[model samples]
Target: MKKDKPKYKQIIDAAIIVIAENGYHQSQVSKIAKQAGVADGTIYLYFKNKEDILISVFEEKMEVFVENLQQIIEIDASASEKLFKMIENHFSVLASDHHLATVTQLELRQSNLALRLRINTILKNYLILLDSILREGIENGEFEQIIDIRLARQMIFGTIDETTTTWVMNEYKYNLVDLTPKVHRLLLNAIKA
Candidate 1:
């Protein structure tokens, strides 16, 4: 219900900036409220606490991310092309939004075990998309028949995740999006038939 409200998105975007700037541990609810231009008490109406805000931020961003990926994959193209587009799109979006890049690639990883578990749960749907791509590749002979789908998904996701994290940690010195081709090629080559 609240997720559909304009204020909900406002708080989520505000939480990203606050958490990115202050680090999640140091980001206070009041800071997020100020960033969102809402009263601190107003945050509670949408979120239960700071952890809720963090989770919601990830959930909201990933929902959009997965939706975009689904649309990208649905186009009439080979699995390899879809996978390339996935890598390219993922890098481009994060490269364009430094705050989101920092929050997703860095701040989100600093949470506690329970929080990480929840984050992983949210991440499952995204992984399933990757798995579907890999399966398609194998079925169509675009990828090697011997390639293990699960391991391939992990490698693809981990490579992209770590690459973005490194770029964010380095303060975006170079064009992260530029690395997409090379990353995509490397991952594709590993599984190519």
Candidate 2:
């Protein structure tokens, strides 16, 4: 019989905390093992190395995030409204998970080039979803026809990423949800038809 996978998840969760708190360079597998309440050898059972864990964390979380966002966007709504909802949901999800946000926004950047490239591949799915929305907006005449779809997608992702990174750096002192409308306005203005 296959061994249970719950322990792997538990280890990954603990690794997020450890990496977020210690930064990637300082986060050791032994530290993650202790945080996860398992032996160091146990982590190897689930992941080949630290890079694997980091990549897995992003892949798993982002898959769920995209899946949920896709469902939310499918509701009856205008493209503009869908865009707004997507931004709101994106920020809200990250804000709700402080540790994950830190790991993703800051610690993850410290990974080596190969790992960063892997993470980028995982991130493209989310970017593609954003791009699709922009395309829809242009099609529906809600977004300006001349706007470069890729640039618009980059701006949206960059703005939200910067905002969240700022919030995380501030120790999350301010309410992130409160910034949704402002971000939405900035994006809408930049892409409006």
lDDT of 2 by residue, 85-173 (tens): 88888888888899899998898888889998998899998888888888888998999999999888889999999999999999999
TM values, all candidates: 0.98, 0.95
Shift in Å, residue 30, candidate 1: 0.3
Model 1's lDDT to the true fold? 0.92
After superposition, candidate 1 runs with Cα above 4 Å error: none
lDDT of 1 by residue, 84-144 (tens): 8899889988988899999999888889999999999999999999899998989998999
> Which 10-residue window in model 2 sums to the lowest lDDT?
1-10
Error of 1 at 184 (Å): 0.9
lDDT, candidates in the order shown: 0.92, 0.87
